[model samples]
Target: MASQWHSLVSQKIFLARNLLGQLENSNSVPAKEALLQGTIELGLRARKLVLIMIARMYQHQHSQPDSLEALGELIGTHSPEIAELNQLASDGRSWWNHLEQLERHQGNPPMARKTVSSENVIAVAADTGPDRSKQALETTLGAMKHFIDILEDRHSEW
Candidate 1:
């Protein structure tokens, strides 16, 4: 279960970075359009996975009929061992929520911050906001991966 969360985070972060890379090398409008749509959608899906995992981790399972019962069943049989996983779930949920809010801004912002004159072609890509967002997303995902690893490694305890 933990590994599942980590893998989802890594995939989404990778997509975001790839999109940022495409933007950096954007030479045509068609390519730019494709990357933008792909990256944002992938990011949203990844964010959704984080939410699902967290919901499964700590939410009490009750035998209510219909969809809510199905959700409970997906978490599997709960035990005292699950208590340790709650902290990881809480942290992951907080980070994912922040990422979702950041994503609501829509398409990537312009990368050229200092380049005023187009003739010089002096566009600096280092200060790009998209890159910062990518890095932040990756960092959060990496944290999630680490947490998952810690649990999976201690499978005996779980």
Candidate 2:
């Protein structure tokens, strides 16, 4: 069971890295969009898997974290990288969900109506442009790598 979880985590990290490579080389708008979405999805999945692995490895009473933010807390350590990853995942998920919804209005009187188009959605996802989105993905990849290393080191102790 432990080995199975390890294998799953490895696969997710590999897939995310592969998607990042494709995203870097993608020049077409549609291709970039698809790659970006894939990267975000993989990053989130990898994070969850890492959290689960950590909980299992440490023999936590709960055996599962309530949320990404709860992982570090459960382990009795605080990691800024984990926090950053959480934020990145949240932002990416929001952007993706927003893209699906297209237009959103706020307030009972509709104080403001925000309409999202493909071009602007991409920009918003990255905070400004593709460069930012790439940076976010890279950050997520780095954090995943860091956690995986920690998981390996801890696993060897048992």
Candidate 3:
């Protein structure tokens, strides 16, 4: 289970970075649109995986519907590391929520097949607020990395 969680985090990180690379190199409007959608999808997936990692580390199963909140409560009882982890989890949640909003605004739920115009695609691609940037994605990934480290360090206890 731990290995599976780690693999999920790694895969999501790779997908996010790969989408960013494609976004960077994209020239045509349609290509950029597609890549931007891909980035949002990756961000959302990353957020889910991060929460799942935290949940699995503390609890044997990731069945908690609101794992982020549960993570806060669990980690809150820890040492001084709570502050940093809380901040990361908060940022991760906020950005993930924003990405979800963007997805809804695009009328394209994750893994949904729908035909959208280039203009509509551009609009969704440009849906950037403070929370929906590359930095947010990076922050979320960093938090996941920290969670992984903490779990690995205390694996014997678990």
Candidate 4:
């Protein structure tokens, strides 16, 4: 069972890395759209990975966490390193939420402010653009690499 969990983690890491690479190289609209969706997918994968790590390290139980917040509760004070990874996962989750909200609202401003239909959603999206996505991916990839190193160090214990 432990080996199975490890294999699953490894596969997710590979897929996340591949998506990051594709995102870095692509600039077309359709490609960027696909990659942004991929970011959301990878964010979920990251959450699952963190949950698995937390369960194995502390809880000794195998069950899906209800949400990232629930995972946070599971991780409470157990491991600072895992907490850092969870924070990164939260950031990844936010990227998708932010993008989705922007889409749903058609780039409208705050309610207190005048709502302008002339507002360009594309420009708003550009503000949170590929550059931001690239940085996020780089950060996630680095964290995953660190995670692998930590796992390798504890391989015998597992």
Best by TM-score: 3
Checking candidate 1 for backbone clashes, the offending pairs are none
Badly placed stretches (over 4 Å) of model 2 are 60-62, 69-132
lDDT (10s digit) by residue, model 3, range 1-158: 65677678778767876776666577898987786667667766765665566566656484543445565675454634345445654663644445556656566444644588775564345333334455665665455556656755665365
TM-score of 2: 0.56
In candidate 2, which residue pairs get closer than 3 Å at backbone N, Cα or C atoms, i.e. clash?
none
lDDT of model number 2: 0.61
CA lDDT scores, all candidates in order: 0.52, 0.61, 0.60, 0.56
Preferred candidate (TM-score higher): 1 or 2: 2
Q: What does each candidate score in C-alpha RMSD?
A: 9.1, 8.7, 7.6, 6.7
Rate residue 156 of model 4 by lDDT: 34
Give stretches of model 4 more than 4 Å off: 24-27, 67-131
TM-scores for all candidates? Answer: 0.43, 0.56, 0.57, 0.55
lDDT of 4 by residue, 10-85 (tens): 6776676677778758879899768766754654565456557555655467656655566656756456645555
lDDT string for model 2 (11-118, tens) is 887897788888868889999878876766676576567677767666674577746658777765555435544564567444222222221211123235467777
Quote the positional error of residue 95 for candidate 2 in Å: 18
Error of 1 at 98 (Å): 5.7
Q: Lowest lDDT 10-mer window, candidate 3?
A: 123-132
Q: Which of 1 and 3 is the better model by lDDT?
A: 3
